[model samples]
Target: MKALILAGGKGTRLWPLSRELMPKQFVRFIDGESLFQKTVKRALLFSRPEELFVVTNRDYRFRVLDDLRELDVEVPTGNVLLEPVGRNTLPAIFWGMKTIQEMFGDSVVAVLPSDHLIDANEDYLTAFKRAERLAKNYLVAFGIKPTRPHTGYGYIKPGEAIEGGYRVEEFREKPDIETAKRYVEANYLWNSGMFALDTELFIDEVKRHAPEVYAAFENASTVGEAYVEVPDVSIDYGLMEKTEEAAVVPLNVYWNDLGSFDAIYDALEKDGNGNAIKVRGKNAYHLGIRSRDNLIMTERLTATVGVEDLIIIDTGDALLIARRGEGQRVREVYRQLKERNDERVLVHRTAYRPWGSYTVLEENDRYKIKRLTVLPGKKLSLQMHYHRSEHWVVVRGTARVAVGDREILLRPGESTFIPAGVRHRLENPGRIVLEVIETQIGEYLGEDDIVRFEDDFGREGDG
Candidate 1:
């Protein structure tokens, strides 16, 4: 069986932690392992590493590689399909299916979203086996038995009982409170967005229904062909709901989408007072006073008094304070920020790089200070900025710097300057992480001012 991981969602509801560049799947919000890593590990339960494929945006290609490298899983480099633009689940899944068919032929394929949390170990394995058996005639969708009257999730009503599953009666969208309560009492299951199907069967069904999307991929001559002809639609809307071959596999797994702060609180380890605290380093501390339920995460000390059912998140760059149950509307904040073209709506203070990472230390109107960490044997792209001049001071290890046309090695206490429009690069050749303090002086200090002439990670324009 081959597995396709959908890892391209922006996850706007999980703002402050999840951004456009760093979505929830890549964030280590739960435990030390990222949700993407956990999803990859889960995929390994039914398939080999060589059979796994990741569908993500072009911007996250390097981040995905870095995360996979952390787990030491070497997926086929070309198998990681990078979309030039996101067209939701329909295009992404169809593209992955086409690629899989071209490479592995018509086989059993499982589609899994990277951002969900599920605990059914043995049950899921058994369900996969059952779904594989049913895939000969139906498109199997794993449906979680609703534990509560959740109005946020879509409901799947079962029709007739089959050998391994049931016929999907209908697909219902997120309903009102009364509707949700009635459905839950009637034994409706929450749509898990998980499916297992025969590749050719799914493709044929998709072509029969959503011919526009199928035709876009079918006419492509190469794997590098852009899926621009496809519309922005979800698999649920484009194919699943319209197909008569849909089957619902009952899954009694402890599943949560964690799409909102309340869902995150529910999935976390709560204290005796019913509170969940997530700390980054040793400096994080939370004190709840007369509070029964809450989530508080901070970089330093946080004291809550007389506040209950709340979410208080304090990152160095931003702060979020919201009522617990009302946390689902946080996407509105993201939308407002985007309308204003705020960078905070997209990236974090600590930006990720292919080689390592860099954090914004301080910034002024004309100057910006940054603390950069370069991993050993890693190098930044050979690039230049037209609008900014940069000064780099090596604080630790050693930096192999390329300034203008000259190449020099700098150790501790040594510094170098690259004038504006001068091509330069930073490299760490030693066995230790190279720490450097970069000071930039420019009229425009945005990240898009760089023009990369060459990059090892295939990033020629942006780092």
Candidate 2:
């Protein structure tokens, strides 16, 4: 069996903590390992590293590489597929399945989302094996019995039991609270968004059900060409609901999509007072004073006063305070921010690049200051700013600097100046991390004001 992991979720509801560039899958919420890492580990249980494949956004190339390095496992280089743009689950799944078939003809593949949290104990393993067995004749969707009226997830009505699972009767969208309650009362299962299927058979079913989607990719040689014609539809709408082969396996294990703050709270270990707190470091803490059943995830010492069933998430730059039941509405905050062209919607105060990362120390109308960290042997683009002049002060290790025609090396406490429109590059030639403080003075300072003469990451246009 092979593994096809979809890792292209934007994680809008998990905002402030999960930004556009740094989504939930790459984040280390519980242990030091991320959800993506956990998913990879889970896949390793049933498939070899060479048989595991990943589908994620093209911009997340470095992030995927970074996490793979963190896992300390050497997988095949050709297995990670990067989608230029996300067209929802159907396209990602289709492309992944197609790639898998090309690599290993006629296969039983388990489709898993990289962002979900699942306890892969005995129950999970049993259900997974059953799903795999059923996949020879069915496009198996692993379903969790609804613990409550969860409006965040779609409800799947299970029909008669087959060999090891049930045929799917109906697929329901996220409903109102009353509707969700009714479905839960009727023993409806929450759609787990995980599946197992035979690659060729699944494609045949997809072609039979969603011809436009099939038309989009069935003839294309590359995913890049295929995605251009792909419709923006989810797997439920494009294939699952339409396919007669759709089946469900009851998975009685701990599972959560972590789609909302309330889900995060539920996934967390609660204290004696029913409060769930996630602190970034020792200096930051949840000092609860008569606060019960509150979920606090912050980077500072946060104290609640007489609050109950509240969700407070502070990420230094933004704070979200909502009722535990109202976590689904948090996506509205992200939508509003995006509509208003707020930078917070796109990035945090610190931004990560392919080479390393940089944190905005201070910014205003006239100038902006940033602390840039360049990884060992990594270099920034040989580029120049159109509207800004830069001053770089090396603070750690050694920096190989290139300003205009001159190539110079700088040590700690050393500095260099580059006037506007002068080609400059920063590289770390040492074995340690090189830290530098960069101050930019300009009439207009924007991240897009770069003209790259050379780049190592094959990047162009705005960063």
Candidate 3:
């Protein structure tokens, strides 16, 4: 069986931590493993590394690579499909299935989301087995039987038993609390965003029901053209709701989409005060006094006093405080920031790149200070900034610096200056990581001032 992972969603509801450049799937909230890494690990449990496929956007390609490397799991890079434009689940899944058909020919493929929190217990394996058996004749969807009234997730009603699962009777949107209470009482399952598909059957159904989506993938020679022509529709809206072959297998294992902070709170381990503290213990400490039932996540020493049932997310740049069950509305705040062109919406204090990452220590109108880390054997693009000049001081390891035409090897405490418009490159030539303190001074110190003459990651003109 081949595994297809959908990793393209920019988790906006998880703002302040999850950004446009770095989404929630790649953000490691706990366990030193991001949701994407966990998903990959789960995928590996059933399928080999070569048979695993990831569908993500063009922007997140490097982040995907970095995380996979961090886990020490190497997969064929070509299996990581890059969606030039996101048209939602329909296209992403369709593209992945089509590729699987070409490579392996009519295999049973399990579709999973890269950003969900799930318990990989015995029930999880049992559900997958049930779905696989059902997928031979039907497009099977794994559903979580709701334990409580949850207004956050869509509901699915199961009908007659078929194979190891049941036919999907009805699908419902996110309902109000009263409606959710009714759904919970009626034994409706939460629509876990995971599906098992027989590649050929799914393609045939897509062609019959979502012809527009099918035609785009079928006719295009490149993914770029396919995305532009494809309709921005979801698999549920395009095929599952319209097809007669829908089925849902009950996955009784614990599952949470982690779509909002409230869900995150529910999924995390809580303290004696019923507070969900994400940062506590060895690496960091979170002390709560008189705080009850609050969901809090922070890096530095964070303490809450007399706050109850509140979602308090504190990042270096932004802080969010809201009542419980109000976490879904974080998207509204993100919308406002995007409309106003707020830079905070796209990045945090630290930004990751293909080489490594850089943290902005300080910034002002005339100057900016950054701490850059270069992985061993990795190098920055051979480029120059037109509007800013840079001074780099090597703090650790060795650096092979190229400024204009001259090149030199610099050790710790050694510094170099590059005037504006001078082509320069920084490289870690040693076996250890290269750490450097960079100071920039100019009229315009924006990241876009870079003009890359050479880049290894094809990110010459990125922000």
Task: Write candidate 3's Cα lDDT for 282-344 as tens digits.
Answer: 556678888899998886788778889999887767888889988999999999999999888
Residue 275 in candidate 2, Cα distance off native in Å: 1.8
Task: Compose the digit string of candidate 1's lDDT tens values, residues 190-267.
Answer: 999999978899999999999988888778775356466777899998998999999989887799998999999989
- What C-alpha lDDT, on a 0 to 100 scale, does residue 388 get in candidate 3? 90
- For each candidate, what is the lDDT? 0.90, 0.90, 0.90
Q: In terms of TM-score, how similar is model 3 to the real structure?
A: 0.97
Score every model by TM-score.
Answer: 0.97, 0.96, 0.97
Q: Once model 2 is optimally superposed onto the true structure by TM-score, how far is the C-alpha of residue 391 displaced, in angstroms? A: 1.4
Clashing pairs in 1: none
lDDT of 2 by residue, 229-317 (tens): 89999999999999888999999988999999889999999999999989995799888889999989998899898999998989877
Candidate 3 worst ten-residue window by lDDT: 278-287
